[model samples]
Each structure stands twice: as C-alpha cells, then as structure tokens.
Target: MYSLKLVTFVVLSSIPYFCYGAKREDFDLQKMFEDMGEEGNKMRDECFTENEMSLADLHDYDKAEDIPEKELCFYKCFFQKSYVVDKDGKVIIESIKAIEEVKDLEESDRETFTNCLKEIKPVLECKDMVEFEKCFDQILM
Candidate 1:
C-alpha cells in the first residue's frame, strides 16, 4: 500500500499541474496515481540516479515550501513521463485558453502573459529544477 504521506504528495503535487494544464484523455491522471506503486518508485529512483540527486534530500509534503533542485528535477521528470506536465514545465497555452476567466484578460495582458511564459523558459532551460519553478513563480506573478 502506498503510504499516506506519499498519497498526500500525489494529490497535492498533481493539483497545480492539472489545474494549469490542458485536458488529456480520461483517467490519465488517475492512472498516474494508481501506477505509482512498484514501477513508479523504480522510475523515480532511476531518475534520481540519472540526475545526480539523492533520495535523502527529499522533503516531505508538509515541508515542500521550496523544493531542492535535484528533488525538484526528480518530480519534474516523473511528471513529464506521466504526461502530467509538458517536457518544458509550462502550463500549455491550450489549457489557459480553455479556462472561462482567461477569456476576459485584456489583449495587453496577453503580451504580459506571453512574455511571462517566455521568461519562465529560462528557468526550465537550466539544469536546476527548483530554480526553474522559482523563476516561473517570480515571472508569472
């Protein structure tokens, strides 16, 4: 059985990504959650190894205020593999367009939006995934 802690992380971690991402086939997210058993753990372990990251540095969900670089990469890689996040760590523009409130943004704001997304690219462009997320948060604000 998956630990309660891991389960909580799955839910919490999935929300922001899903809320911001374009819709996919039905049960894709659900399958990702369900598959996080043996194969998932192994994949995560391999990702940590490949990324020169250590599982020891990973923080629990409650302490996830600022993820460490390597740990963040692990999550990023895993989510990308799961198709929950794009390879570039962006909120797909299609997803943004599908939202009801997004229709109301002024055209000028769209430039700001596009620029902000471009700025976020540099974050993902680097090797440090935590910084990528941080840069996204900063530029996206």
Candidate 2:
C-alpha cells in the first residue's frame, strides 16, 4: 500500500533543492510555489472528478488499499511536474536511480528501496501511473 505521508514527505523535502543552485533573480519563491500549488490543485481536482472520489477521502486513511482509484491519480499528476514522472507513467529502473541525487535519502536506503521495487511485479507496469507511484511509495517512503 502507498503512504501519502511518505509521498508528500519525499516530494516536499525536495523543494529546497529545486529552488537552490539558480540565479537569485531567476527564482521567484512565491511565484514558484504559487504555480506549483495551482498546478497541484488542478491535478488534484481533475483526478478526484475523473475517479469519482473526493479530496476528503484523502483524510480517511493511511493505507494504499483505502485509496480510491481516482485519488491515486493525484500522485501521477503531482509527479508530472518533475522528471520523476516517466513519459510512460511507469516506474523506470534506470531513471529511479536519479533519486540517489536527492540528498534526502541515505545511500543504504536508496539501494534497498530500488531493489525492493525491482522485485515487485505489478510495480513494473505503468498501465496505471498512480499505482506505480504507490508501489514506489510503499518502498521508498
């Protein structure tokens, strides 16, 4: 099952890094967050509407099993903003190592998480991107 806490944690934890290493004038913190928030909300609403679920459902539980099909779409939508979202909406073995560059995770955990997902079967399919994210969340988070 996927944990939204971990999903938000890992993704939120990277905000600083995404903002840093750029020219000061080139980065507008307020505008950037505003944009992300808008995009996030738009995706969230769209997913909820399409999946026939409500955002309130997100508060209903912690387990992935409790997650509704449409709500899962939010994960895929959020991931779309980053390179982390694969073009095929599936988890990419080689591309996942990119998380290694993310300072939030330790070296040991990274390998373990990657390998664990590698062992999982349904996770290998991108037929459902949200489920793919859930698979990674179960391990990586």
Best by lDDT: 1
Which 10-residue window in model 2 sums to the lowest lDDT?
17-26
lDDT (CA) per prediction: 0.47, 0.44
Q: Model 1 off-target regions past 4 Å?
A: 1-35, 60-65, 92-141
Candidate 1: what lDDT?
A: 0.47
- What is the total number of backbone clashes in candidate 1? 0
lDDT of 2 by residue, 1-51 (tens): 123333343543432223232223323423333333444556545655655
- The estimated TM-scores of all candidates read 0.40, 0.47
Count of clashing residue pairs in every prediction: 0, 0
Measured on C-alpha atoms, candidate 2 has an lDDT of: 0.44
lDDT of 1 at 8: 32
Candidate RMSDs in order: 10.7, 10.9
Give model 2 RMSD, 1 decimal: 10.9
